[model samples]
Target chain A: MIAEIASVSFIGGLLSLDVSAWGQIMVSRPIVCGPLIGLLLGDLKTGLIIGVLLELIWINVISVGAAIPPDATIVAVTCTTLIILTESKLSLGSDFHGSYRMVVLALTMPLAEFFKTIDVKQRKLNARFVHYLDREILKGNLKAVGKVNNFSLFLVFLRGFLFSLVAISVGVYILPKLFSYLPYAMLVGLNFAYRLMPALGLAIAFNTFRGL
Target chain B: MQNLGFLYILVPVLDKLYPEKEKRIQSYRRHLEFFNSHPYFANVLVGIVARLEEEMAKEGEVKSEEISAVKMSMGGAFGGIGDSLFWGAWRPFTALVACVLVIIFLGKWEGAWLGPVIFLFLYNFLHFHTRFKGVLEGYEKKTKVVRLLKKMYYLRTIWSSHVVGLTLVLLTGLVVLFRDWEAIERLYFLAFFLSIILLNRWRISAARLLYLLIGISCVGGYIF
Candidate 1:
């Protein structure tokens, strides 16, 4: 379990880097990272389902200008990791198993906002790098430019790695325990909510075209 | 900030063009001024600036202030177009297609993985094309690259993508309903869908709606 958490956190760190610190490739998008994490954890199907759901839900949550949107990629990574890891721990063929994904998703969704706050702080800290480079360039230490840029990228990676590491570590310990305490009635409700999730996604996607 | 990024990208070019340390530092300082644009499209400005700097190095005709002016104006213009076309339209269109593919084929077929593959391929194809070609075109044609972008009919693509995305959303709702749902389940799905669409008019955010739906579900679960 410790090994699994560490490996997933490592990959999660790299994927989060794609968000802004490095490549802006759509790989950072939930649709990609969800399944990627799923495949790593040996549950591709759960990854795909969760990826598509999160992708649609946050489809319009783009970062325009300095306004940082909630970090959907982190949510997808954490949620998918939690579901796949916990699903294996619980005994199979249970009545509540089917709705487990929804419960995990509902609980984990707020992590997006939490991750964003951290992300905004990181960006604020990055301003110091610019001033540092400005000073170095004035000193004719042109080589410091690449070194500082690489260091900044490393910092971004470290931020992501440590964030996922802690989030997943704490989540793996807490989620299944909380899930076990849920009554059967609540499980059924979550099942219904799970099935209705696509509708919510579709409606939000439709809203993107609202004024068009 | 993008200013630092702009400086980083121009470093090699500046190094080559200005061998004298004082001149090179001046060129570096020049690029360190404010710069921001869509990441992909920013390459075009980089190319243009590189070319202008080369000319300034060789012939001493182009003024430094003119280069900054070009960066400011074109950065703003490209930022607007790139935001609308790529973020507003192209991304959603490609993402919708991938999602609908996932909804339709995830369980029934082994080809479910193709959704993400096709999405990456389709998106990056245009993305790389614009990124690489924009630089060359901007270097070759300079400001006339704007004319080239205008001829690409990006507005038409934006409009069509939105229309297609709307259709796909409706199609996904239908498929989800009839796929395996019972009558009661179907009714519940419809209720949630309509209420969400209606709630959207109140400008409720997606995150808020997410929590609200879950809250309702938990309570309804306890009752029914």
Candidate 2:
């Protein structure tokens, strides 16, 4: 369990870098990251389902201009990780697994906003690096250019790594316990919600084109 | 933050163009100024700036202020276009296509992995093309690159993607209805879809909607 958490966190850290710090490649998007994490945890189906769900839900959430949208990547990573890991740990019959997934997704959804707050704070801290580089460049220490950029990127990676490490560590421990405690009625409700999730995602995706 | 990235990209170019330490410092200072643009399209500006710097170094004809002006104007322009075309249109289109593919073939076929593969391949094909080509095109054509961007019919692309994306979304809803869902389930799915679309008009956040759905489901479960 510990090894699984650590490895997933490492990949989470790297993928989070693709969000904005290093590559703006769409790999950071939930569609890619979800399944990637899923494949790592040996659950491609859950990963694909969760990835497509999150991708559609947050399809319109883009960082345009100065507005930083919620960190969908973090939510997708943590949500998929929790579902796969916790589902494996639980002895719940296959019948209840669908409901279990919905419950995990619902609970994990808020992490995107939480991670966004942290992301904003990190970007604010990065401004200090710019000032540092300004000073170094003015001093004819041109080499600091690469150093500062690399250092900032490292911080971004470290932030994602540490966050995912702590998030998955805590989530893996708690989620299954919570799901186990839920009443049968709530589980059924979650199953319904789970089936309805794609509708929500599609609606949001449709709303994105409302302007056009 | 992007300023730092911009400076990092231009370092080797500056190092080569300005051998004198003092001149190199000036060039570095110029690039180290604030610069933010769409990451992929920024390469276009980078290429243009690199060419401008080379000219400034060799011929001393292009003024530093003109270079800054070009950076400011083009940065804003390219940022807008890139955001709309890539982030707004292209990403959603490719992702929706992948998602629909996943929904249609996930359990029924062994080709589910192809969804993400196709997504990555389709997206990065254009992404890398722009990233690699934009630089060369910008370097070769300079400001005339704007003319080339205009010719790409970005608006047409954006409009078509949105249309196709809508169709795919509808198609996905239909697929789920016929394949996995039963009679009551189909009605519930339609109701959820319609309500979600209507609720979206209220500008409710996705998270809130998710929670709301979960809350409602729990109540429905308890009652029925």
Candidate 3:
């Protein structure tokens, strides 16, 4: 549970900080984060594997204007993590691994979308926090800076823990049933996402480049 | 290499637009090398360089060649290009295309990891090599980048759109080939292409048509 909690906070903190707070790093991106979470859960291979698809597919899902990305990497990582944690591989002696993995992916995707909206809303509300940080910077107040950074990191992790918990929980509950029913439609939808989503990624990357 | 590829597309834009001293270009080239050496920071590094150049111009340390009017005449032109090429064309083309390839081949997820790392190699190689070429001769960098872009026969914006279109087409093809998806998607694609043809005839801007198509699809997809 602690590991799970830490994983979510690191992600949430990095995400919230990327475009909104310090804007210092985008390395915390899905390509980076997916492998990371996989390692944290003691499954580096799975993390690296999922990271690859999510990274390539959504490489251009960087921060832009008012628009928020569908967060492909987060979806990949969350889905993978949830699956590996709850379902056992051959070494783990769990017979339900195959079904669990598939069901988790199916369940975790919608959960990812739900959390994205929440993150976007949080970002919008962060305007005042941004102003406050700016003022503290202007005043050169170390105490203020330290306080804000610490508090923000805490809040970010708290949010991640809650989101991850709910997401994983819901995945465990109804995923197997739903997956059995709509595997066909879901496969089609994912294929659609994989191909078309890349184009969307290009639109994003191009939009960020300076006009010649 | 993807970053390097992007550099070929962009840094030449900077050199042609700025045309600064040998030292600046040399320093700039070094900076690009540093930027691309790290896999993820390539575009952001370019953006940082652009910002720094702008600041240098403001301080009267350097003169603006083409980017001079960036604030006034450029009208967010540089920003738009950066956004388009880095975020839009190079990143997505490098990324999503690979994603499509992975799924199209039905590769195992583990094997698909090469897509991004491959991009990294492509970008860095191109970035450093082009910079070195630029410092060796005047206009050399411009010639090289232009040639690269030309051979690709693709503008960044257009290329980005093409990636999107191709990926969508592939996805649709896969869906049809693999499983019985709702038959409605076929109708939806037909309607989308038809509307695009009709709208283009009326001379609606492509951007507007994009939004219109999306809007129409969402609404139509919902009802039908």
Candidate 4:
């Protein structure tokens, strides 16, 4: 489990980098990163299902100028990792659209909101790094500029790694037990809602595109 | 990330243009002022700024204030256009297409890995290709990138329309698959769809809308 968390969190860091650390590559997107993590966890279906769902709903969320959208990449990596890991431990069957998955999905949405606040704080800290660079430049320390920029990227990477590590670690312990207590009928409803979620996802996608 | 990301572009360009130490320092300082825009769209401005800086260094034809003016003016426009087209349209369109492909080929868990591979390949191909191309066009052609952006607007429209069609088809597939759904369930689905559209139109946050959906679905679960 430690090995899995470490490796997956590293990948999370890389994808999180796509949000701002480097190229605006779409790799950080849920559709891409979620499946990739799922593949690593030996459950491609879990990853793809979660990825596609998150991609559909959060399709319009973006970092336009100063506004930071929820860190969908972290949400993707953390949720997919937790879902697959928990399922393997519980010896659950390969029903990717089951109620357990829906419960996990429900729990994951708010997690993105939490991580987004962390991201805002990290950017604020990065602003201080920028100021430090400005002072270094004033002192004719051109070489320091590269170090400062690289350090900022490192900070973001570290933040991603730690967040993923903690989120997945906690999620694996909480999600299964939480769902295990639900009534059979409620589980059935969750499964139904899980199936119906794609419609809402598609509607969100349509709302986004219609505005275009 | 936005400010630092652009520094990578500006530093090298400024380095090549300004050989004098003092001049290079001035160039760096000038650019270090707060600048933010959509990252992908910022490439065009980076290209344009590189060109303007080159003009300033080589012929002194452009004033510093004019370059700053160009950056300020183009920043908001690019942000709006880039957000609308790339974030609003292109991403959702490709994602919907990917989702449809996944449903078609791997819905039953057969060869599921292929879905993510296709999605990553298709999205990155469009994303990085246009990103680099935007920079090149902005650098080589400067203001003429507007024409290219106009072309992009048409492409975005075409792609978005296709996504809408694909989504409707997928929704139809759902209705067909669940033919045995209770009448109340069907009505609930209709209400869910309508509420999503109406709430989205009213500009509710996606997260909040999702929370509402989940809450309502959970309560409906007990009643049904």
Candidate 5:
């Protein structure tokens, strides 16, 4: 149980730092961070590959001054997680191609983004949190704000991590049913994602040279 | 340093309150050195500090004299640097870079133990090689290794990141060329990248590039 708790908390700690401290590094990005974490949970290669797809399609996604761009972190992590689950299941014995799994997640990312707007509302608490910290610190009452920060960071981490865990778990559990509904385009989309990355990278470079 | 993590401030506070003054002070002043010793341990050290502080102040939780002084000092001195480096830059960059690389290279199901493994290895060993040299550590300062590392640190990291980005682009190109209509999709994405650079160089701004990028986005779908 401690392992589970630690897993949740680790996700929380990571999420806390994503916006607050670790924004400078791209480790928190789904491609890198998701795969790294996925490696821990096993199936790192799939995580890495899926991450590449998300990274390209949403290359410009970023939170800017006072604006929370969609939670690509969740979108990425959740999708990768599903791919891992589905791929492994198919690999084991199922007569299925797991590629459709990520396709579903890809389709759902916008929905996930819609739900994640709730995070921006929590952003409103930043000022009040700072005020609380100041008042407590001045009063020599470290407990008030320290606990607040700790708990706030915990919840911040928990919400995304849990949401992801549940979403992935549910998606993984139900993929066989969803497989029935998918069109041929799903396979093409997956195939496109597989190649889209290198194309974008070269384009970025070629364009850089041409303009220069 | 991408940014100093809030953990920086945490370390010094723990150092001040620590029952053992000497080790704590030494570790505090030479925190990076200690970190060079072990990242996981350093994280544990961070956890210890927070947990100890909580344990010490559980109930009515009157702040101790030493803890209060440390807190007062923390807000003014350590907190700023910690906030700036960790919050403002370093941690975000590190976290994002790490996560992004993992996602791209490894994916959600796949993984890259090497990346983090190399990170841990380099973090612990590279910065502290002089320790093995001991007395020579003083003399070896005569070499350019320190500056060399610093320079390499500057160039190699940026170089590597660009490589990752470039690789992504190339992958996208091959995929497009093969998967979709040969000529149209190829030319469209070609034009997309061309425009990205032109826009950036001309100061066309992202707002305007949106029109062009929208067309480019469609190219991916068209290729499919």
Candidate 6:
């Protein structure tokens, strides 16, 4: 299970890198990556559910220009993986529809902000590489240009892989323990939030189209 | 990395334009400056650059400054347009449909995988097509891409309403899934929907409203 989790995390990281690290391909979007991880876990349904939720919620949060938005790929991938894995370990039964998944999602929300900071740091590091490439361009060193470009992509891949690896590693132990103690009332709220979050996400999406 | 991505797209063109090492280096430097644009419309910028570079290579009438000026000016304006068009309109349109499917198949394993697959197909179809065509069109027609995009304004309007309609369907699905909704709770749901629409109409930040709704749900948990 550990080996499987690590490999899946690595792939998820690579896809997440697709958002901007290389091509602005739509593969890294939550609608895709979430179910991708779920498919890897042998449960495409979990991935689809979480993917739709995160994709809708973060529909407006795009990386426009220099501004870095919260990394939804990481959130969707991690949350889906954690929930599915945790459910498997505990045998969370076949009747899993509401609170359990919602709790996992609620817990994973903070990681989006946490990973955003990491994303910003990665970009800042890429800035240094860009500066180095600038000098390489001056020297007409095409070899160095390719090297730097490849290295930057590698760095992004590494950032995502390591982040997910660490998140899932830590979460594997912590989430189950934490879930036992989370109040019933809080879970109820999460279930409500689960319902409300879609509308809220849609509202945000609608806000973007206001001028049109 | 999107800043660097522009260089990648231009590398082949740069190599083709400047045969001499010194000329190539100079051309490379011209494009290596800080660049960030809406990813989809970047094709337009790339297309324009490709054309300008071609002109520079053939006629030498197009100065590097003119090229740089176009890059600087067009990037921001087109970035705005692309953001609103692709990110704002196209994405939400696809996502709303995808979300509706997820809601429809909330617990059905057989049907669950369909939503994300459809989403990727629809979105990438639009996303990649625009990217490829934007570049080709920009390269072929140059500044006329703006007018071309202007002609598509009605499409944007139509897509916007699709988003609104899909959103209402999603909200309706949520309300249906609640199992037992009292009259007052139904009214609150209606108010919640209206308030968000109104807040958006007034141009209040949706982020603030999102946080407020989350907070209300969190604090109001005890009441309901």
Supply every candidate's count of residue pairs whose N, Cα or C atoms clash at under 3 angstroms. Answer: 0, 0, 38, 0, 74, 0
DockQ of 5: 0.17
How much is the lDDT of residue A168 in candidate 4? 88
lDDT of each: 0.85, 0.86, 0.45, 0.77, 0.45, 0.74
DockQ of each: 0.72, 0.75, 0.11, 0.53, 0.17, 0.44
The top-ranked prediction according to DockQ is 2
**Candidate 6, residue B199: CA error in Å?**
8.0
Which portions of model 6 miss their true places by more than 4 Å? A91-97, A183-212, B1-3, B153-159, B162-171, B174-224
Worst 10 residues of 3 chain A by lDDT: A203-212
For candidate 2, write residues A1-212 as lDDT tens digits.
89999999999999999988877777888999999999999999989999999999988877776678888888889989998888867878878888988877877888888888888898888888888877888887888887888888898899899999999899888888888899999988888888888878887887876644
Total colliding residue pairs, candidate 2: 0
TM-score of chain A of 3: 0.60
Report the C-alpha lDDT of model 4 over B33-131, residue by residue, as the tens digit: 777776777889998989989999999999999888878888778888777666766666667677666655555557766766666676677667667
Q: Candidate 6: global Cα-lDDT? A: 0.74
Model 1: residues with Cα > 4 Å off, grouped in runs: A91-93
lDDT tens per residue, model 3, A1-212: 65675565456545544432333233344554665676677876666545544454344354442355565544665676666565552232343343344345444555445767877676554545545654553454423434554565466555565666566556544554554464334434433433233233333323322221
Residue B63 lDDT in model 4? Answer: 95
Which residue runs of candidate 3 sit more than 4 Å off their true CA positions? A1-36, A39-64, A89-103, A133-162, A169-212, B1-75, B100-112, B119-224
Q: Summarize candidate 4's per-residue lDDT along A1-212 as a digit string, tens digits.
A: 89999999999988888876777668888888888998899988778888888887888786666787787889889889988888765544556346777787778878788888988898889888888888888888887767888888888888888988888888888887887688766766777778677678777876776665
lDDT of 5 by residue, A63-127 (tens): 33234556666666666655655565443233334335434544556643553576766655654
Query: Which of the two, 2 or 6, has more lDDT?
Result: 2
- Candidate 1 structure quality by residue, lDDT tens digits, B2-77: 7777888899999999999999988987888878888889999999999999999999999999999999999988
Distance from true location, Cα of A148 in model 6, Å: 1.6
How large an RMSD does model 3 have? 11.7
Q: Estimate each model's TM-score.
A: 0.97, 0.97, 0.48, 0.89, 0.51, 0.85
* lDDT (Cα) of model 3: 0.45
Candidate scoring better on TM-score of 1 and 4: 1
**All candidates: CA RMSD (Å):** 1.4, 1.3, 11.7, 2.9, 10.9, 3.6
Residue-by-residue lDDT tens digits, candidate 6, A111-162: 7778888888877888888888888778769666667778888888888888
